[model samples]
Structures are given as C-alpha cells and as structure tokens.
Target chain A: MSFEKVEHALHKRRKSRNIGLGAVLIGFVALVFVLTIAKVVDEGDAQRAEQALRINPPKASE
Target chain B: MSDASLNTTTQDGDAGFGDFFALLKPRVMSLVVFTALVGLLAAPVPVNPIVAFASILFIAVGGGASGALNMWWDADIDRIMKRTQSRPIPAGRLSEGDALGLGATLSVFAVVMLFLASNIVAAGLLAFTIFFYVVIYTMWLKRWTPQNIVIGGAAGAFPPMIGWAVATGGISIESVLMFTIVFMWTPPHFWALALFMKSDYRDAGVPMLTVTHGRTSTRKHILVYTLLLAPIAIGTAFTSIGGPVYLAAAVVLNALFIKGAITIWRRDETQAEADGYRTEKRFFALSLVYLFAHFLAILAEAGLGQFGLGGWA
Candidate 1:
C-alpha cells in the first residue's frame, strides 16, 4: 500500500476508537445520573408515605 | 493533485470525538461538576433528584462551553505555551472555527435548558458564568492584565453559587461564602503554577503574576492570598453547613496550606531550582487537594446534619 493509503487508514481507525470511547463515557454518566435521581425519588416517596399514616388514622367500624 | 492531496486536505476533518471533547477541557469540567454537586447537596432546600441531575448536567455543559470558548480565543497563546501546545486547536487536531461553533452552541443549549429545569435565577447565573469566562476573563482580562487570574478567578468561583441558586432559587450568605472560598483560593493556586511555569507565560505574552510582577512579588502575593483564604474556608463551618467535623478539617488543611504558602514565600529561585521546582510543584498539587477537601468537608458536614450527627450543637 502507498503512504497516502496507510495514513488515511490509520486516521479512520483512530476516529473509530475515539467514537467508541466517547460512547462509553456518555453512557456511563447517563446511567449513574439516572440511578441517582431514582434513588432520590424512591426515598422521598417512602418518607412522605410514612408521614401520611402518622398524620391521619382510619375510623374503627361500629 | 493526486489522491494524496485529497487526503491531506481532509486532515483537519480527521479529528474525532475526542478532539471535540478536548475542546471542552474535560478535567476542568469534572472539577466544575464536583464542586457544583457539593453545593447542591449542601443547600438548605430539598431538590428533586431529576431536577438536581438536570441542573448539574446543564451547569457542567455551561462550564464545558466556557472551556471551549477559552481554548478558541486562547489558541494563539496556547500555541506558544508548552503546557498547552498539544490542545486540539494548537495541535491542528481541529479548526478554531469548529471550537467556536461548538462553544456557542453548547452555551445557548445549557442556559436555555437550565432555565426550563431549574429557575431563572440558576439559569441567569449560568449565563453570566459563560459570559464572564468567555468575554470577560478569556477575551479581555487574560491578555490585558497581570492580575488576570486574580479577577478572572471569579469565573471558576461562580459554580457553587449557581448550584446553590438552583436549589434555593436565590443567592444567600452561604452561597457567597462558598464563592469566596474558591475566589480566595484561586490566586495562591495559580500563582504557584506560574512560579514554576513563568517562562511559558513570558513567552506567550500572557502577563501572569510571575510574568508581570516577578517571582518575588508573586511569592508574596501567594502567601497573602493563602492567609486570606484560610479564614473564609474555616468560617464556612459556622454557617448552615458548618460543624465540628468540617471545622476540624478546615483547621488542619488551612494550617498545612498556610505552611506551604509560607514555604513558597521564603524560598528563592536558587532554592527552588536547586530542587528542580519540587516545592512549587508540591504546592500546586496540594492546592488541588486543599480546595477539593474543603468542599468535601462541607459535604460531610451536611451529611452529618442529615442524621443529627454533625454541625454546631
């Protein structure tokens, strides 16, 4: 292969490597961020539920 | 014009995702994200997880946009400086036009999205931060003043305040204190680097403290700023985020930081060079830990308060 052909091939390979790495990074960040928000929502809902039962009681049947 | 010419013409386009990301200055972006996260968590109000996540994400984007624009404008000086010469623009990995376009696009996206997710106050702060870093610090102060890092440090210092505003919907004394911690810390941190890398600034004609005021003056300035930073950092403990744990950490860290600054102040170029700038480099590295630990301490305090185990009794 000629020098030009080799150089072009290397550049293409490098671009592919970069794209792979970028995908992994963005994916990891998004996953962690979503998990954090889920944890917050779950905890907040539990806390509110506990408070609701404490603040109000059901009437007993005659 | 053969096939070789076509390949050569497309060389700049050969830049990949990494090149564009490098334009964002990921390392700096990470620091911005971490500090902003701490600020959000430490606030007095409760923030929804999704809201907090979106706010931090947009803030990080705004921070990254600032970095891109900084690289765009500083491409000239960056080409001259050894420490920054390999950045995408200077290394010919990407074109300056591409960097500017990326910065501008991200800046608008971040600000507009932050407003939708958070509030006008948080979004306004983010917008100002982008404008300050890009227009004020990078374009104007960087090339014009020897005190560039001193005043320009405000750009980095705004993150925590923006983070605070995201939750609180306004500014407060606590947020201002956080801002001051970073602001006061900036000079000593950067002056240490400038001490060792004076030649870079001199060659680039950037007028850093070491370049304009000379090393003697820079050393003195570092000590002065360190002294100022200690009280503000320690004083943070007495506020809503303050507690024994943070106070203890602050005392110890500031003592060490102050001692390091004094060491930098007392030594001459001969002593510094004799040891291969080991002292200056140590101070520079320590400055990073110093800032990181202070913010961490604040988080610890907030964490403790969550369970009735921390802060002023």
Candidate 2:
C-alpha cells in the first residue's frame, strides 16, 4: 500500500497565510526592539545634555 | 461527495494572506500614509527619525483598522456595489466576524503603540480618528444622510493633523489648514466620482449625493464645493508650510479644477451619456492628480526650506 499524503490547495493557502502572519509578528517584534532602543538612546542624550548644562552653566550676560 | 471534490470546494472558499490584507483597504490606506507622512515631514519641529517612522506606521495601521471595520459594517452594500463587490467579505473569502476581530485588535494595538512611540496627543487623535471612521462615519452617517461623505471626510482629514501632532505634540494653524484642505477637497472629489459611477450608489441603496439628490444636484454640488476648495488650496500657500512652489502649483491646479467643475456643471445627461462621461472621468482623474500635486508641492517646499529656500519669510 502506498503511504503518500495528497497536498490540497487549501493546505497551501493556509500555509501561506500562516507564514504571512508569522512574518508580520516577527517584523513587529523587531520594530518594537528598535523603537525601544531609539527611545532609550534619546532619553539618555537628553539627560546627559541636562547634566552638562548643570555642570557648566552658561553665563547670564555674554 | 468524494474527499477530492470536498477539498476543491473548500479551497475555492479559502482565503489567502492577500485576501485578508484586502480587508484593510490598502488603496485607501495609501492615501492615509501619504498625507500623514507629509504632515509629519512638513512640521516645524523635527521628530527623531525612529519615532517618526514608528508613529507613521501606527497611524497607517490605525487607518487600516478603520477600513476593515468599514468593510465589516458595509459588507452588504459592498456586495451590491460593483466597485466594491470584490472585497473579501463580499467575495466570501473572509467573514464579517473575522473583519471585526482584526479591526478591533489592530485598533487597540495601534493606539497603544502610538502612545508609547510618540505622545498622548498623537495617540488620542489616532484613537479619535478610528472612532470617527468606524462608528460615527460608518455606522451612523453613511447610510442615514446625504451629507454622509461631507462628514465622513473628516475621518480622512485627521491623519495629517495626527502627523503634525506627532512632531509638535500640539495642533497649530498649519495643521488646521492641512486638515481644512483635505476636508474641503473630499466632497468635490467624491461627488465627481458619483457623477461617473452612475447607479452604483443608487443600486447599493447608500445615501450618496447622487442617490439622495438627482445627478443635476450632485453636479451642482460638485461645482460649489470645488469653488470653495479653490481659495483654501491656494491660500495654504501663504501659510508657514507653503512657499512659491506650492503657490504656483495651487494656482494652476485650482484653475484646472474649477474649469473642470464648470464643464461638469454645464453638461446635461444626454451630453454626458453620449461621451460615456469622458469629461467627468477626466475631471475625476484630474482631481486625484490635483490633490496629490498640491501635497507634493508642499512637501517640495518643506524640502527646499530645509536647504534654506522653502517658505516665504
């Protein structure tokens, strides 16, 4: 007896949909990671700038 | 039925990824993306590149969510209308329940992500835009009133405003003008479409201007709205966002748009039917170009200003 399974078009379509969804999810995760990194870096820069101003405050009348 | 036959039947009704994507109304989403991007770019405040990109994506997803909700709500009419007959719900590739779930989920996701990426104001505007499009426009205004498109157009006009908020964290005259430009442009644009897309809205039983009022009234309405749109489109030139490039483009485009409206207004049914709505169709095509070119000119002006030549001092 042959032991082969027939692949239906429905299976292919479902598979494609699953892959598309998987790709979207992965892409979303990567985006969030990048966004978080960018936000953290931005806040850090702002904090550093604030500190620098405190340490070497500008003269009132230049 | 044999298994093979059953499989064939099942596959025929099965939806692919693209079918699901169609639920988002990608074409409309393109307009949302472009206008929103322009708003973000043209703002006086400089957004971090990453924040800008993320905010735009969330705005687009929010726009798409509303579209899906619209498709869900209007599935019946969509099935009747020739233009929208091939949408996923009408085509039986996706169910209304599927659309509802996707739309609801994405709406929340987009709003929350936008808040995290940008500020509360931008996120709030995005949320309000979604609510306006899905509930106010789709559920209440669309089928109930002839003024549907006029009011519903507000939902579309919000994206650029949201984009500006992303950069500036507040609304300004520039953003308001951007909003008004789109708000005024929508009626004439859609009315011209209704002129050419004869009997589609009528057959669908949607209270489009053509259905509620006769074709003659719709034509007259288009002329009036186009006339109103002209000053706003041209006047935006003097705003902080506008410059010489925008002014020149606006002058030419508005002249052409008004000329098209007059031609449309003058024509009777016999003349339009004889030429298969050539003038109306041409007018419709020009309307699309008119809006895009105006926005492009604004973008061009902003770009030039970056290099010390954009807006008038």
Candidate 3:
C-alpha cells in the first residue's frame, strides 16, 4: 500500500503563524518571570536595609 | 490535510501571521520605540536596565495597539485612499473585528504590564496615548475637521513624555520640551505628504488640509508649522537634555528644515506639477530625517553626560 501527502500555501502560512505566536507567548512568559524576580529581590533588599537601620539607628538621629 | 479543510480556511478568510502583524503598523511602532527610548535615557533619574527595557516594550505595544485601533475605525476611508488601501483591514487580509480585539487586548495588557514594571505615571500616559489616538483622533477629529492631524499629532507626541515619566516618575520641563519638538514637527511632516498625495484625502473625504484648504494653503500651513517648529527644536538645546553637540545638530538641522519649507512655500501649483511636487516630496523626506536626527542628538548628549562631558558645566 502507498500513502499520499498534500501541502498548501495556507498550511505553510498557518504553521508560520502558529510558530510566531508560540515564540511571542514564550518570550512574554520569560519576561514576566524576570520582572517578578527583579521586583522580589528589590523588595527583599529594601526590607533588609530597613531592619538593619532599626537595629542600628543613624548617628545623626542620636 | 483535507480538501474540505482547505476550502473552509479559504472561505473563512483566515489570515497569516504577517497579516496580523501588519495591523500594528510596525513603521509607526518604530518611531514610538525610538522617541520613547530617547525620552527615558535623557531624563536625569536613572532606571534599572531591566525595568527600562520592559517599560519601553509596553510603551511600544501601547502605540501599536493604538495603530491597530486606528485601522479598525478608519477601514472605510482606508479603502478609499490609495496610500492606505493595502493596509490589513482595508485589504481584507484582516477583519475589523480582528484589529479591534487585538488593539483592545494589547491596550489593556500594555497598561497593566507597564504599571507593574515601572510607575503609575508612565502607565497612565500610555493609557491616555492609546485613548487619544483611537477615540479622540481617529473616531472624532480625523473626518470632522481640516486641522485633524494638527490636533491628532498630540497622540504621537506623548511617547517621549511617557518614556521620561518611566525614568523620573514625574513630568518636567525637559520632557515637555521633548514633547513640544515632536508636536510641532508633525504638521509640516504630514502636510507635506498631503501636498503631493493631493487627491487621497479628497477622495476619502477626510478633510485633510490639502483637501479642505487647497494645496496653496497646505503649502502655507507647512511653512508656518516649520517656522514654529524651528524655535522649539532649537530651544531644546538649552534644556537639561541639551548639550553643545545637540545645539550644533539642532542649529544645522533647523536651518536646512526652514530652507526646505521656504522653497516649498514659494512654489505654485504649476511649478509643483511641472516637477511633480519634487520640492514637497523632498521636504516630506527631510521631515523624517529632521525629527530622527533631533532625537538622536538628544540621545548622544545623554550618552556623553555619562562621561561628564555632555551638558554645560
């Protein structure tokens, strides 16, 4: 037995479109991940500095 | 896979990826990206590189969303105008619904993302820009008045301010000056194109200056705007973002720009037709370079500022 395959312009364009959309979605996820990490790290550093300042008040305040 | 499936796809008029992208008006998006980046970098406050990149991305997406929305609303006139007939909506490559959906979704997405990545000020400006471009300009002013682009130009001018806000978290004189330069440049740039593409606005009934005011008046308008633009652009040189390098570039660019405008102002229809609006065409081309070089000079000044050699000490 033999099998036949078919191709069309529409299929090629549709495939490309799917791939493009997939790439964009993946990029968006990665960007959001990085942004979240940056924000969390920033907040953590700020909190740590605040705690340190409380434990050792500034000489100016004294 | 099947003949029936192929028939259905063709019948449904499904678009390719490029068709979807075309709805965003990538050329205009590029201008948005450049101006916004310049604005952000020129501000005194420093931004985290990651945050800056994300903010700029959202701003560009917002601008593209507005472009898509504009296409959705102007599909009819777009089909009539020779210049816009090939655009996605008008060309039947994408439906108006597709543009509307994409624009609205991206508008919301960009605003929310910008707020998360930067401050509220930048996000607010982005929201306003999308509204101004889509509702105020496209839906309201474009067809209602000959001075459409004059007011509509504000929509394009906001990016730099938004960019500045992203960095500084507030508005300032420098950002306003940056905004003013683009605001003033738009009239002459667009009117020059209107001069040569004479019948487009008329045929589409959009009330462009050239259509409603006549070519002579359009020429005069271009000259007036160009004259007004020179002082603002040159005046930017004295601002915080401006330096000696910027001043030099502004002086030379403004001089050439004004001369081009004068040559355009002096022409009659007969002369214009004889040379096929060559002067007008050149003026239009120069307008693009004029705006780009101005922002580029500002960027260069900002770069030099890092080395302590930029602004006047």
Model 1, span B272-293: residue lDDT tens: 9999889999999999999999
Q: iRMS of every model, one decimal?
A: 5.1, 2.3, 2.5
Classified by CAPRI criteria, candidate 3 counts as: medium
Model 2 spans > 4 angstroms off: B1-5, B10-13
Worst 10-residue lDDT window for candidate 3 chain B reads B4-13
Candidate 3 error regions (>4 Å):
A48-62, B1-13
lDDT of 2 by residue, B184-282 (tens): 999988988888898899998889988888889989999999999999999999999999999999999999999999999999989999999999999
lDDT of each: 0.88, 0.91, 0.91
Alpha-carbon TM-score of each model against the true structure? 0.86, 0.97, 0.95
lDDT for each residue of candidate 3 in A1-62, tens digit (9 for 90 to 100):
97665666767777878998999999999999888888888889889999999999988853
Candidate closest to the true structure, highest TM-score: 2
lDDT of 2 by residue, A1-62 (tens): 96676667776777789999999999999999999999999999999999999999999996
| TM-score of every candidate's chain A | 0.67, 0.90, 0.83
DockQ of each: 0.16, 0.62, 0.49
Better of 2 and 3 by lDDT: 2
